[model samples]
Target: MGGAGNPDGPTLGGDDVRILLVDDEIDLADVVSLHLEQRRESFSVTTAIGGNDALSTFESTEIDCVVSDYEMPGMDGLALLRELHQRDQSVPFILYTGRGSEEIASEAISAGVTDYLQKRATSDQYAVLANRIENAVARHRSERARQETELRYQNLVEASPHAIFVHRGPNILYANDSVVDLLDIDDRTEIYGTDPLSYVHPDDRDRIDRRMRKAFDERETADWAGWRLRRDDGEIRHVESRGAPVSYDGQPAVQVVLRDVTDQRRREQRLEALNDATRELLTAETPEAVAQVAVEVVESVFDEPFVAIWSYRPETDQLTTLAVTEAATERAAAERNEPRPVDTVGGDLEMDVFAAGEPRVIEGYADHDDAMTEAFETVFMLPLDEHGLLSVASVEPRTFSAAERDLLGILARSVVAAFDRLAA
Candidate 1:
């Protein structure tokens, strides 16, 4: 048997291994415990005279492995094995006995013993027992670490807010809760094993496919790219996503995280269109020209059909409509029998916003008792400094988001700058 003197003997180094040695023969147990400790400097051995003392010691101390004799006074090694397993099923237990036979070895295996060794007169037997103890302890620690790592990964994936999915080849392997909600699906099972590219817009599929291929084939991370996602109901949503090569269930796959950017993209497009309109506003030489640019910008960028601009007249204490969109004209055509008054402005809402030089958004404008409110449900009144007021109204109820309001403010300032240039 390979002992401490053998160069290739089993050796373990790191944290100390706590071992509980149990035998009715006190001298035999002490000698075996001493030999094990001398063979491996990392081993710390504790001795117990019988099964009852072994149980008491096990409960008090954190023992990594147990090396016990077969026969004892009240509780035998097999009886102690059952009690120890009830507390911790994974702890390593080895049966080292003098009366070893096929009957005892078979019985120890049935009781879930980690290892079995027959006692011998030779002193070298302790070295072999030490090697078995080291192997069992190493395996136990590795398995525990793996279970902890998997538990943490599961918790992180479930708590993430962004849509995450793993795909191998063309089939989806895993998808989180956010993915189901993003696709507008009632169940996640519907997405599993299905092609991920089927949900992508027709125009964007080829580009997304290329990016995913690069990620998997090159084993590199794909940079974020914007794409249109077509939902189950045929609604289109704008999303940005990044992908990286990952190992899923022992196979190479790609894990992608998708973030919804529909609202952000729409705001960016509106700002770009507004910037173009600002260039047009700079060319206007008169207030009426400035109002035309404002009307067109509001109609096109905001998708609001009913838009009107009013010029303030201090001498008459009134606001007269200087420019209106085609939709606005069509809306008022049914009520306009005679030439409207030059001072005929909108209701008190417009007058208040103009007088205060502040913007106001009125939802349910159709409920107001005003001539212009008859056909519109929402109205956004923005004052162009002291020059005039710009109003964009919708037929359906609408509430402008804070970002939309900021964009509208930028439009108002552009018009004010144009008016200042005209005055100069």
Candidate 2:
């Protein structure tokens, strides 16, 4: 037994539990504070003479628990409990009083009291109250820590830009907001409890499933680069994805993080293709030989059936076909003797582009010449300085994206350089 001035109590640890002791009677409050202070190793007690004073102390200080007398001149323990609940329900409150009644106990319970103790002089009464206070405070701290940890994890997941998913076996348990955007989904509920592999491209689904299973079974990690993921819109995008075994809902699950790498992969492939095409064009001895090499490389790299290179005749002011894909060789040969006007191509904007020395992309092929009729719905044309024109066509509409146009422009530049060397 020790008072605030006594040193007979246990030594306090670095992290001491702070407590607020409230009672209208100054003597009773002092006695309770002394008992708590005796456990100086665990508790640091702050005394409040009344409920109002207790409220003020609670606000200004960081208190772990509130121990209050039932009846006071200003506010009873029940009223104090109501006020405390309104402010924060997380702080543990215990009602310690000499008053006794089952109705009073029931009322305290209904008001959300953390613990109730009947005041007595049995010598061990304070010991029992002290135990109750310690237990309640410990539980509250533990729960608050857990909630804060969970909140932090949730915030991190929400803020991440990469798509993330949690899955058990094959069933998806959760998908973050970024996953919704990546998959073009309206609601997360649409993916919950569904197989995550369902969205993977059919060609890659089996491989991804195998990797996922191996990671889960062995509790290892797996990763994939340049894999295809088919979105809800049926468009396939390249992604670099990783998977690791994680705990979800108290069970072993797989956490997947996927990042779209379509543009990056395309750029890499385009660079490689351009290098190959430039190497081929560099070996040509004549402009016609350069056209043959350029058209062949473009066709092989793009996998398109329609590719042609025209040689500009300065005297005739015409662009005549020099090289054409075999599938369109007959059609191109028929127009070889004829000169297509440099100003316009099938009433399209290629005329302005030819004059401006820029690339022209016919996304819909709506204004192409008669020679291209029923041949292609999309066309990408770039002038090779005053040497000739390099054009690639696809039967599918809208096949010429910005990326494709840029890649072709690069190829045109290389071709123009080769033509200049030949003319030299």
Candidate 3:
């Protein structure tokens, strides 16, 4: 080295760090190496005569950071930065240049330089470079870890089975695979940045909106169960969901996870309807009054157009209508006041249930009888033991599930018990 560094200057000593110093000036490079060597316990510095030499050194040796002169022969610092990025973008590169300018700084930044420092004649310049190198490397490591974490979260959300959505206020930012399937959507692009509340059922929108906003404001999680949602195809569904305040894409937002629970909710409502009917059945004074209340309770939980109760007299072997729903009364021309013997009526599901004293379920009733005047698509008949049978009819095909079958069976037993009590 041509000149010696000041011994009085602050020592650049701390944790051991590997640094690659690049400069074309052999004398300057030697001088800088000498200065760094004085603090050899803290820093292990290697010198490169130019950018090409720096690249070779980078490939062969492990380097925590690169400090290079912007103006150099053969390859410059900016070119060296590009080469280092192609090999490994994580290593920090600093442009310590004598020809410092706004244009150079901008160009170096665009080339992905970590830090820019102007060359000074003072011996303390090396100390400054040492500090800058430590900071730049620390920052780069931290950012890399953050990016890795975010990538992992993204992958998890994409593969989730439940409908997962992230929203800021009313606008939806992201949605998962299940959301597309639940909404019956072909493309996900249509969902981004749209108001999430627009997809909610008319009756449930306000409640969900309030919950989401409250969760965001409180910075806590909010859970909502048995919420109705209208799909893109205009069919209603139920969902249980939870929302929490989270940082998404560096912005304050709420992340929501929705689980489709339409089947579960329907089962719950059917149970509730059965309980309601049981309460009404216990208080009923007459069998006719019991039939009317049962029809009302069952009809409240189902989207059926018609419901009726028929009393079965074993002595006469006849089926007589005790009560009919309002819709049933409106649809039929005359009151079915004329009692018909079980053998006289056609051999349909209704007659079969009465004869066997077992429940009967029919799907697509029109298929069974094309000439059928009844507009209903599905029908169910549950025998009320020795008293009568309950009939439920829906305009939608295959509307009742297995859970409904079990629930309806329980309700039928309750009605029978109530009838036996009143008779005794």
Best by lDDT: 1
Per-residue lDDT over 54-95 for candidate 1, one digit per residue giving the tens place of the 0 to 100 score: 999999999999999998889899899998998889999999
| TM-score for each model | 0.70, 0.66, 0.67
User: Lowest summed-lDDT stretch of 10 residues in model 2?
Assistant: 339-348
Alpha-carbon deviation at 393 in model 3, angstroms: 3.8
- What's the residue-level lDDT of 153 in candidate 1? 61
Off by over 4 Å in 2: 1-13, 49-53, 70-79, 97-111, 115-128, 150-159, 167-175, 187-195, 201-220, 223-227, 245-254, 266-310, 320-381, 391-406, 413-424
In terms of TM-score, which candidate is stronger, 1 or 2? 1
| lDDT (Cα, tens digit) per residue for candidate 3, span 228-249 | 8888889988888899898777
Instruction: Go through the candidates in order and give the clash count of each.
Output: 0, 3, 0
Question: Residue 411's C-alpha lDDT in candidate 3?
Answer: 77
Best candidate (score: TM-score)? 1
CA lDDT for candidate 2: 0.78
- Model 3: lDDT equals 0.78
* Model 1 regions lying over 4 Å from their true place: 1-13, 20-32, 47-58, 66-128, 147-199, 213-218, 231-233, 245-259, 280-293, 304-307, 320-344, 362-378, 393-399, 417-424
Cα RMSD to native, each candidate?
5.7, 6.9, 6.8
Which residue pairs overlap in candidate 3's backbone?
none
